[model samples]
Target: MMKKAPTPRTALAPGIAKVLKQLHCPLDVMLMCVRWYVAYGLSLRNLAEMMAEPWIEVHHSTVYRWDMKLLPVLEKAFRLRKRPAGKSWRMDEMHIRVNGEWRYLYRAVDKNGNTVDFLRRAHRDKVAARRYFEKAIEAIDADRETPIKIRRCKYLNNLVEQNFRVIKRRTRPMPGFRNFRCARILLAGIELMPMIAKGQMQCAHGTHPSADDQFYDLVT
Candidate 1:
């Protein structure tokens, strides 16, 4: 009998491959960067070092670029928009270091521990609060299916507070981020994993055919 020919790797979707290749990185590297950034709360430099390998070179600048470019896009793509409004919303703040100084992260979540919005501000004063609420409320207005009356519910807020711990563990190895934009992207990627793990997003496991293959299969 003749030996079987080797099967070729399927081509991925243009959009998916474009983004992945634009950063001069692999999907696993991109995913790992996000994971370490969010799960450990590590700075870009730390993550770069941790991800560095004998074959591939990992640098702090590369981490910075990945965060600034892809993190927000990932967040917007994966973020949940419409949900039944909870009776109340909870807001809180955490401090992280940027450029060797402390900065605050203001976050809001619904009654169900789902993220509403987040803001990074210089201080936690009334102005900062106003800014955070403005963006959060705007997001709620745009995404909500029904009108939700606001109430003060600390318990709901506590649920949202739980996110910090998970990211903190990941950050411990690196300590803090040097670039704020990169830091934001890292957070978005990190936050997205839970949603994916919970079966909310369709992940591209290597075993499956590429998006292009699916399209081609459909078209053909």
Candidate 2:
């Protein structure tokens, strides 16, 4: 029997390491704190208190600043590092309330649970759905990758709906977002968590020297 060839890993972007150097906290600690808030949808105040259990003292406002600073770094790093998703796109839309009125959240993922993309729209109509469909197609099309078909019906489109279900569950802790821009950013974070859980995103691991180096060098 022949051993399978190893898959090449994506290198961390140089900009990430450069920016992280000027920060005051440890890389692992900062990553852990921001991940908890993003993964669990904790309020900044709640996150600050939670960190206190481990003797890490930081204010809620500080946590807010950390998220603002760190999320874009992690988000871009993960996007560049993750593998291209499948071509069969499963897509859906659901209404979420922001500032007292409803809005449409368009979400789609490939078969392997890799999120294609998400968009928050002010209306839900043919034009909106079509726009989302085009975006989903664009997202899934990578080098040598073309989305073969779109699956919007419930039968084969459970992935996006399930993602929405998780989003709905996780978001219940926070009553509402202040505005659509903030709401979209939070939803994007929520969507990214699943990819990380699936082992499909940029991860820092001790056993992997390259990624471990990137993470340490950045966070230090």
lDDT of 1 at 218: 16
lDDT of 1: 0.57
Off by over 4 Å in 1: 1-21, 40-64, 80-87, 134-147, 153-156, 198-220
Best by lDDT: 2
TM-scores vs. true structure, each candidate: 0.62, 0.73
Q: Pick the candidate with the highest TM-score.
A: 2
Each prediction's whole-model lDDT (CA): 0.57, 0.66
Q: Pull out the clashing pairs in model 2.
A: none
Error of 1 at 99 (Å): 1.1
| Backbone clashes under 3 angstroms, per model | 7, 0
Tens digit of per-residue lDDT, candidate 2, span 27-96: 5666666667777857888988887987899888777666667676666666777766667777788888
